[model samples]
Target: MMALNSVARADSFTITGVNGTGVTASISNYSLVGNQFTFTITNTSVAPGSTGTITNLGFALPGNRANNFTLVSSTNSNYTIAHDLNATSGSQNFVSSFDLVLIDKPNGNPTFGGGSVKNGIAGGTSATFTIAGDFSGLTADQVAHAIFARFQAVNGDGSDVAGNGTSPVPEPMSMLLFGTGLAGVAARARRRRQGAKE
Candidate 1:
């Protein structure tokens, strides 16, 4: 006999500005199923004459030990997000860099200095982007705890924001086991019906 359980969970959050730039960000429509995660992020400026750019975005997996995170999809008109690298050590962190450009600045406005810019995401106007990835490295006992995102503007203002969200739902192995159990039950039912017919 086998006991199988299936759980589905989803979560979302709004990111606060820590860089004194009056820029706000939000993550919505987040869902997790069997090690797959997806979410959307929207960035906007609250104050006038304020423009910014996103430099980096990352997610923190607390107990997971595997580093096989892969970006599945992304959609945004203003910015481009690309997978950067894993963290140094022991911190199951996945990072992605943003391609954004600043526009119409005074003489001393800050810039990326041609170091990390990629696809030219502009400020002042609102921009929204979505990202989906698979975290197959997580074990049955390990789960994701929190999500972190960081960004910077042309004025040298930046923020590293943390948001709370739903933890990893179920392990892939557990899902497989549950499927096998269901198949076994179906097979037994068919056999019983054939025996009675004979």
Candidate 2:
């Protein structure tokens, strides 16, 4: 078998009953590269109501300081990043906040999934978006321990979702070590087979 240099691991979780707004959110995909974590969020309709618009999204650092977090990039152009101090104070302050607005559109409908706005995400309709950033000067274990995300939709509705237990893939060196052990076992087995044949 061909050797692998590295492997990527992903974890996901669903966010339901978001502040009782009948809108559900989920982390469809999550990955860590170095100190950066890239993730995708998918929002779906849960009950009957107007299509709730996402107002803000925030990520908390828990015990970490605000300086440890950095804003990398977002695929949505209408969203802006800022610091959210309402969640906590002092060094335990939340990392960053993303504010979203629907502009130049009638009915004030928010657009997701590459600028397609529908009346409501209800009836099995859904929208997906992505956010990525770096947690500066932190190890993989540290990053995994610090994955807490909060999101808010219009009318002061929101929800909190934690991205914990999402472990990083095994390092290339570990894979190599495992491969070496398997090779040795195979060689021994082959030698035993030849001795029996003789």
Candidate 3:
């Protein structure tokens, strides 16, 4: 079997959700270069000062691949890398389907058997997580159909986000294109609002 960091490639996939308007997430694989892998969740449903939190997120592993379980870090404490997220203390979903999970806490949860729901990922922000380890044989397909849970301020106070899609690797160009598209959409809406105001 090929070990991780053997090749430098990025793969990306879409994560769909409900009870919220236009909520989505993405996972970018970049482990082949010994750099890092990231998962970003964007919630665009809740208004300002409202609370729309992503409490749980799980990624599946195709062909029953093993988790390397190395290091987990993020720009903020909103999320912690929990290859094995815990669900006993607080609450979590998708323990059997998803092979990896980015949890709200990461003290002893280094394996994907459970989960947590503390200070979950916030809404209206692009919360990105950096996870490192031996993810040899991991591909973009594994993350295509992601599953997650959100709480508060959504369509009737949050719901589960789950679905599947293509297995295109998260290339930098692809991410840029996606980001640009989102920006374009936002700009158009902003202009429309401005026009309405005028």
Candidate 4:
């Protein structure tokens, strides 16, 4: 059996295949439930004449535990360039960015995930948005947690959803376990001190 803690994680996840169109990103086998997790996607590179939109904002948390994790809310925005500089072809050049963050835990707790995007593109622009999960009904103060989540962006032709055409992998469970271990150590130390005083 494992426990949950508030320690931060050192593991990192790479948002690859996020090139031309976008990426359908998700997490799986998360032990934590009833807690909202937020993620973001940014465009690194785009075809000179290509365009797309950020929609279909939803996530799936398996285990028939809709109560575990639910898509409570989402926010997205972008900047588009009307035309190329020093050009008279009247061809509009559009550059877009995306940002997503976990503003609050599902139980209406004030906590955040990751950080925000500074620029707009994958390399140039950086956009940020957030998806809040709701875990208000859970009974325990320290509930087990895990997650399976994903998002996608598609172009006029759905075949080109991902710019690089790859998938996003889940972060390692080591950090989560490390957090549990550290908590155990702290608890043990406190217990020892209390016993000495008695």
Candidate 5:
């Protein structure tokens, strides 16, 4: 059984594009509790047809936050959570350094449904990650836009799939509002010009 975790108004983000098959992508969940942050990442697709399994989630910490956070534990024994990861795991590349990585062992963990020969997050299975931080504001605002996912095939046919997400994905929405405000300004300017001409 998985550990007893607080559901507590969790926040989620979408991850997509794995091996072009688009199989097993996810809308993962996360929450913060007193400087201890917990999140669940699952690989599954309801529409069917996913060829790859998610192998790891690598969080690229911003600035020099490598020492601020530490991997407390993973709910699954088949997984290993670590800090100060500067390299890539499978096909997931890191453009920045000092990452927190949760990786599925190559040996694989058995939790029913035959077995994941590749030791990845099989469809419908989830791993809740717990991370402890020394800082006070250890909220999603600090970790948003810091996540990337990796995938692989147990049979080795595929595993080089990578996906990234910004938890709140703020840019596009902010842009929309900014665009609207600019358009309004432009319209007002045009109206003033017409009044002056009159």
Candidate 6:
């Protein structure tokens, strides 16, 4: 349980279709700074050919871990945060599995859940959806925690992103090293002050 601060960490995971091409995807900006979280989604696949779905793509703000948060703001009125599918092109397929977990730091460990979406080839050329949610119950002390989303692609033959591994966590040694570095800097500063006095 780290102390909350003025900043919050955010991350993104892209679920590519079977063809490794783009799919129907959307993203919107949210009160990332105020609430200490933000996100974005980009469609890499062109239109009229490839397609896929991106689902279960969201993270929980560390502060609001107790009470689940939901995305209230969205670029599209019909857009929702839960399981979704995208198919605006051909046979291209984009989908995912697992849920999102936002922690306190780039290396800090946090909780996670299951989520996903399937992308297909239908609708228009491209579609975007941006959303924001209420994280009111979270304590102020947990604000600095980071945010991350677990992604996976299911079905359609061979290996898929659904089986993709989770984002790596920082090792204990790394934290120890960071602390040592900070201590060294403090010691040097103290020695310099003492030398100047003498």
**What would the TM-scores of all predictions be?**
0.46, 0.45, 0.52, 0.32, 0.61, 0.36
Better of 1 and 3 by lDDT: 3
Q: Write the per-residue lDDT of candidate 4 for residues 22-87, one digit (tens) a residue.
A: 333322222223354433444433444343332222222222232223234333332211111121
Ranking by TM-score: 5, 3, 1, 2, 6, 4
For model 1, state the Cα shift of residue 59 in Å: 1.0
Write one digit per residue (lDDT tens) for candidate 1, span 53-168: 54445455444334445444445433333333333222222232212222112213232222232333334333333333444554322322344444444445443333333454
> Which should have the higher TM-score, number 4 or number 5?
5
lDDT of 5 by residue, 1-198 (tens): 544333433455556654465654543556667777777777664344555566666666655564566677776666665566564433444354445666555534321112233566766677777778743533454463466666555234554444454445443445777999999999999999999999
- lDDT score of residue 162 within candidate 5: 45
**lDDT, candidate 2, 1-198, per-residue tens:** 766422233554544432344555555445556655655555544344622443334454434444434446555444444443343233323334222222212323332112223332222433333334445554333443443333333223433222333444555566889999999999999999999999
Candidate whose TM-score is highest: 5
**Candidate achieving higher TM-score, 1 or 5:** 5
lDDT of 3: 0.50
Better lDDT candidate (2, 5): 5
- What lDDT is reached at residue 12 by model 6? 33
lDDT of 4: 0.30
Q: Model 2 residue 94 lDDT?
A: 35
Candidate 6 has a TM-score of 0.36
By lDDT, is 3 or 4 better?
Answer: 3
lDDT of each prediction vs. the true structure?
A: 0.43, 0.42, 0.50, 0.30, 0.57, 0.35
**Which 10 consecutive residues of model 6 have the lowest summed lDDT?**
102-111
Total clashing pairs for each candidate: 2, 0, 13, 34, 2, 41
Ranking by lDDT: 5, 3, 1, 2, 6, 4
